[model samples]
Target: MSYATALKRAARHNPAWKAASVFKVAVEESGAAVLDASGEFQYDLAEDTYALRDFTQEERFTLHQPYDGDAALTVITANDPNSDHLILWEGQFHKILEVLGADALRGTVRYRVKALPQDEAVPIRHSIIL
Candidate 1:
């Protein structure tokens, strides 16, 4: 429904994410020179709401390398999910990447991603945290 909702869903399997902060969202551009128009995220970690900042020319390309390009979110965690043993949640974004071939969000890609082992899902509320 919303980015906040998405994060909450992503958090069920990642309790550490409960305190995680979404800092940035970078997309892959088609021109090969990552633009800054695709979309940006407004984060309120304490409340768990990540909204689109604005629509613009998406940024892409890292001339330094290929495949190294990634659509990623910079996160500040309360603790290292892996080291803390709370990183049970597997990342499904890669699945989308696999299906889309790493260029799905070219114009604007919309899809719902679910965490594996469905049972881990829990109800979440929108609020600003972290």
Candidate 2:
């Protein structure tokens, strides 16, 4: 099997990875933002600094991506997350800042995201207001 395929399989079967949902934000006529579920995916979330150092040499070499100090990194599989998307994880909202890296073989996508501000993260019946 290709390295990309193997990597995806490992991430899928790994118990450490968490399941999450992806959402797209839409603005209403009243100028209020609402989150709509777009897709589902699995990810391994970690502090950017720790993840950078913890990643294997092959993984780092494959990514060739850099990140900001305040950003958190999430190694994701299954769904492609856009920069404008928001992720509902651990009962909180995280805004995707940018895609750090994408495997050339389409195995995974690494994203840099930050927890949304309290006011912007207000959830009403599972939908968030941006």
Candidate 3:
């Protein structure tokens, strides 16, 4: 039910996701937070991006987009005290949407969309396979 457990489980069941995640490695930031892969919410990340706690190597990659603000990637560079740049896999996550979902940028799916059904209803599919 927790991030560590979920990562472990994914590693156990999904062999493809083993090295793709941080179970085998000694990650500096290991915690819960949703992560999108191939334009899908593949990982169910914890609600708080800055969850008043440590972030694993994976969590630091996502850029948080709240309901009421702009989206930008959060990175703790080598100079920071609490976080280390060594743990940061790369600067590739600077673009939040790209890191979140590669498909999201290529007309596959929209990363953050807020549209309430007014009169007519809109259909939503759980997964998009292209």
The C-alpha stretches of model 1 lying farther than 4 A from their native spots are 1-45, 53-56, 72-130
> Model 2 RMSD to the real structure?
9.9
Top-down lDDT ranking: 2, 1, 3
Clashes of 2: 0
RMSD of each: 16.7, 9.9, 17.6
Assess candidate 1 and give its TM-score to the true structure: 0.19
Tens-digit lDDT track of model 3 for 5-38: 4444444464332121001112224543233344
Q: Clash totals for all models, in order?
A: 18, 0, 7
lDDT of 1: 0.28
RMSD of 3: 17.6
- Model 2 misplacement above 4 A: 1-13, 26-69, 78-81, 122-130
Order of models, best TM-score first: 2, 1, 3
Residue pairs that clash (backbone atoms under 3 angstroms), model 2: none
Q: Report the C-alpha lDDT of model 1 over 1-130, residue by residue, as the tens digit.
A: 5443554566557644323222222223452322233332222223222212113433555578765433332222322212111111132211112211121222222212222344543212222332
Cα-based lDDT for every prediction: 0.28, 0.51, 0.23
Sequence-dependent TM-score of model 2: 0.47
